[model samples]
Target: MQTRRTFAAGLASAACAAPFITAAVAQSATTIRVSTAAPPSDFLNRALERMKADLEAANVGIQFSVHPASTLFRQGTEVPALQRGNLEMCSMTTFEVAQQIPELGYFNRGYLFNDHAHLRRAFDGPIGEDYRKAVSSRMGIEILATHYLGTRQVSLRQKRNVKGPADLAGTKLRMPAGPEWLLLGRTLGVAPIPLGMPEVYLALKTGTIDGQENPLSIFSAAKLFEVSEQVVLTSHVVQPVFLAMAKPVWDKLNPDQKKAVETAAKAAATWGDTARLDDEKTIVETIKGRGLTVETPDLKLFREAADRAYTGADATKAWDLQGLKRVQSA
Candidate 1:
């Protein structure tokens, strides 16, 4: 009683790189159900859609259903759903994974990654293998590839001079609910408010939240500029999300289908990464065209505060410092 609409895989055409078992001969074509909080406008969702189309078009003897905008599960619930066998796939953030496996919080730390390349090297190297094993062993999930969304910057409801953390002591800022995000919010010297992605716009519009932070591309796609006034270019953390699938679901897939899923996931991640990197080059001007003020605060002061937060705070007690060093070396 899935009731989810999907197409049967067509015969593999000459256009396809490999042939899949035809639907007529295959009795176990499972549908991969993906849940994400990103809206259709966000590149993450678009990349998921592309992955769906790719698999279907390749006649991979499987189906894909991408439920965007938290329509399937709320922002923070997809991981649990995947663990419970209620979901098949998702883009799980490091912050969410660290919530369950605290040691992985190293990846979610502020100023930990210098750029997307550094993040990728850290993840693609041996350090990342340990993390993959931990998540798979404990969470019943298998990660496919890294999705680089872009660097996070502060988007405020009111235009002001945010020279340093002291400039925003009482500001009510929305951070994704987790010690990692909340700790970073406190490091930025704001009253960290936990809010889901879907609720951010209304909260900002209603003046319930003073500001939020995300990549420039997401800020533009989410239309936060409509409700906000300025963006502080903190460039705090280069965000990376894992294209993860339930291990149970993966175990059910034949080797061919598993390979297909991995291929599509990596291709989609590349699609998103390329688009976001290209967008970052000009999105500053794009938002400015929409009449939003973009400011570059002294990132040095912000980095110093973040250093103190990582070393002096209790949250880092569970972080993998060895892995942190490996990532830094990467």
Candidate 2:
């Protein structure tokens, strides 16, 4: 009778442990790895944190492991890693995508977006959907959300005041090593010197480059004011970072899992967008407080130059001018 009682007890214990064991297995099976080139303090990283919190709160069995500041993959390799199925997700720039899909470079065109509202309409509307489709079909990556990085502006080292594009003529400016960026530098009347992001600080400090262009937040984050003497509010290019997942990984998600991820991604992007917009307002004063001269030139000249670049044959070769016109009108 004691043996039968013990057997009954064993069955009861097994039954009690089954749910726990199943949950553990489910959690282990759904681990996700997300990578980004942004530092831990960056808005992009903060957004990822928000995403993690939301996903976990939804009681999804998935687990998120974040790697920031290019820890998991080197700079410029994130996209390739995602394509190869070596990574689950990443925050990538449209410039990187433009290298493969040159037509996508249209979005990077100088002064294409009039303001944040215009940009939001274009991206959150049909243009965004079209680009997402193209990226999924051509690159095998699924775009979840678009997060604003910041508006690009010029930061100079020698206290030179730039009133217009003409003032930047022959000035050696650090630019990203991409065709569109090269063209932009040329259009803006600067001698374009291609450099990596990690090298910009040392390049400025050592006088390897005369100036560089980036949003105020990036300038402050890198503490570029220490080396930079002046800031020109060019607001040349409005950069948007893409929150993307490998198509293979995205395809494996069930409907509910996909919905959870999408909701989290959009929420995180909204957080990043709001944070960046707020930062843009205050970062200029913060930079000025550090003894850097700030200038707001007649943006008319720069805008005209940008318009010329947009309609040029080179730009037209890669972009759908009609689509661009539609975005502008929208």
Candidate 3:
């Protein structure tokens, strides 16, 4: 079996039939400072760009200035940037959100989401509404939409037959610098090293870490395929990132502006989600062409290991198990 993942061009709008908001009234442009660690090539960015196009075409007094690839804010800084009024929007990660709202950490747990669809179900429906409220109340951020990031897999610089969690023992794995992600490192039986995104490539090339894990879309877009020799498809986390805006900023918007933003976000998510799902279906072959060996590990073993890591843990004692159940059943 081949482990594989395209960001289809989503400039105008994503399969959205809703007519553009055509209010002819013009006001001072509200320039939203969008920042992301994702490259312009990322499907999320493409969708955001598409939303920007839709918003601009709507004649809404909105200017979406997207700063991609950490040009504006480095990884782990967007949340604060939003709070400080330095940034207007970003694709918020569960890992970062869990930092402040600890119980929300359940979303960061591996194997919790059956797939992208299940993940979205939790966020798009009642459970997602609950999450949005929690974030808005506790952190002052408003979630506009949720989009799929591909399933996570382990990409290593050295080829090894990784059939189970133990196979990765003592392997230094690079994870986002945080207690939560480091916890995931321990679950995978790896020596976790905390590093920023911009430093990963040089670290891999310099042997500072043995491997890293991310969605295949990220792996390909970052060109990690060029540095890593193998990909072990653990498929642990079916990741989803949120399109978010600062709560105060969102509140300050006029009714029509708010409607335009919401409409654009919805259109963007719909387009980006479909593109990402398609990318996951075909990306492995592209990486393999660059001389990477894709391996399917014992996924059952991996899932069981992740489940064991969270059970009866004091840190997760306050988690919303019922909500998790709802997401699982969804």
Model 3 over residues 120-211: C-alpha lDDT tens digits? 77778888898899999999999999888678888999999888999999999998888778878877878999988778888999999999
Q: Which candidate leads the pack in TM-score?
A: 1
Q: Name the weakest run of 10 consecutive residues (lDDT summed) in model 3.
A: 1-10
Best candidate according to lDDT: 1
Candidates ranked by lDDT, best first? 1, 2, 3
Please, what is the TM-score per model? 0.91, 0.89, 0.89
Prediction 3 global C-alpha lDDT:
0.85
Tell me the tens digit of each residue's lDDT in model 2 across 1-330: 999999999999999999999988886657778888776777888889999999999877778877886788877788999998899999878788888888777777788887777888888998889989999999999999999888889999988768889999988999877778888886587999998666788999999999999877777777778898999998888778899999999999888889999999999999999998999878888888899899998889988876676565474487766876787798
* Per-residue C-alpha lDDT of model 1 across residues 1-330, encoded as one tens digit per residue: 233322222323432624344443455678889999887788999999999998998787887999988999999999999999889998899988888898878888888899988888888888778888999998889998889978999999999898998898899999889888889987788899999988999999999999999998888888889999999998888999889999999999998898899999999999999998998999999889989998988888898898887786788898878877888888
TM-score of 3: 0.89
lDDT of each prediction vs. the true structure?
A: 0.88, 0.85, 0.85
Better of 1 and 2 by lDDT: 1
